[model samples]
Target: MTTDPPPEPNREPTPGRLHRARTAFRRWRRTRPFWAAVWTGLGGFVIFFLPMAPLGKILQVGLGGIAGMAGGVLLMAMALLILLLPGQRHTAGVIAVIAGVASFPLSNLGGLFVGMVLSVLGGSMAFAWLPEKPARRRRPRRTTPSAETPVSLGSGSA
Candidate 1:
């Protein structure tokens, strides 16, 4: 009886679920203002948490704890809005900028200026983000024989 060789293992490994998930996440992030959302969220956290911390005794310069809290919450909401509705990024960015500015007088110096800077940067980034254009397929070039070239035959020349 003739023995056949075992089937060779696949040279290219198939992607696992984790890889697929990561790829999906990357695609989603690229389509939206991901970094902007991250920055705004962090800024909001800072603005919201600073006023409640012990450092509040030294950094508190706003109208009151309540105003700071409100401003922070508003900024955080704007960040979420930007992420959820990228088409409305302009509006959300403007709102976030206003909130960041307001936080200066409402929150503790806009969370010691850190939160305000982050919020402004995030808002601007969100406003500036644009979708990538789809790539166009190029047609293959066709070459024609040139008249200047002489055609060769199997017969030897004298």
Candidate 2:
């Protein structure tokens, strides 16, 4: 009987779909306003995890859970608007600023520290960011001095 061929050598495993997606995302560069909006939204989300409480109380505001959630939700909505509505970015920026200011009382000093900082940064960027225009390729004019053009030199020159 003929002998069987030897087994092939092991090969390295390929990256999974999720890994590829993450790599693509990392490679993608976003505009300043986009990054700002993402950061602000992230900050707002962080605030939601903290306990709802007044400045001194810190994370002890469980009694007003609904209110705390409401504030967080509002901030998230504004951030979404900033991202989704490019035309309304200015308006969204204004809202983000308001949310940052409100975060101090709504989520206490912790929110003020995190949420306010991120929101304010994002708001300012959104408000100030301008879309960049693509550069145009212009050909240098191929100009040659006209033969009829006059050139003056010392009268003694031949």
Candidate 3:
């Protein structure tokens, strides 16, 4: 009979590249105001795009084209700032809120109110976001009764 080769040692499977990347991204996102930035950026896009869109004609009023463009750009910049400098999120959030409110009168009714609301909400979220504190390990509790406490015997009566 032929001799069998020795069995290989057991080893845990390594994570795939995509899985590693996703995990890293989740960790990064947890430490930052990710959703806030996304909302602000989306709002800015709407405000900026509406002015140049054909539907803009229906919503055009005042000096919206130029002013709206400027406001939208400013809001987008604030979103980037919030992401890049989490510590300065308050300032960026305030700026974004202001820009969003201004867009209403200047850019297609703040992209038909959708962009304005989104920008405001994003700014609010950014302003409220706080870093999470590391969790502390707790000591295991004793299951046995301590000498300091007396144990009851048959409900204190026979």
Query: lDDT (0-100) at residue 42 of candidate 3?
Result: 88
Supply every candidate's count of residue pairs whose N, Cα or C atoms clash at under 3 angstroms: 0, 1, 0
Ranking according to TM-score, highest score first: 3, 1, 2
**Model 1 agreement with the true structure over 45-76: per-residue lDDT tens digits:** 88988888565653555465777778789889
Q: Predict model 3's lDDT versus the native.
A: 0.87
Give the alpha carbon lDDT tens digit for every residue of 71-131 in model 2. 6677678778877776688888888777777777666653648866877787777887776
User: What's the TM-score of every candidate structure?
Assistant: 0.75, 0.63, 0.76
Expressed as tens digits, the lDDT of each residue in 1-158 for candidate 3 is 99999999999999999999999999998888999999998898888878774655635654787777778888889889988889999999998998999888777789899989999999999999999889999999879988999887766555
Candidate 2 wrong stretches, greater than 4 Å:
1-32, 52-65, 110-112, 144-158
Q: Could you say which candidate leads in TM-score?
A: 3
Error of 2 at 122 (Å): 1.3
Model with the higher TM-score, candidate 1 or 3: 3
Inter-residue clash pairs, candidate 2: 52-61
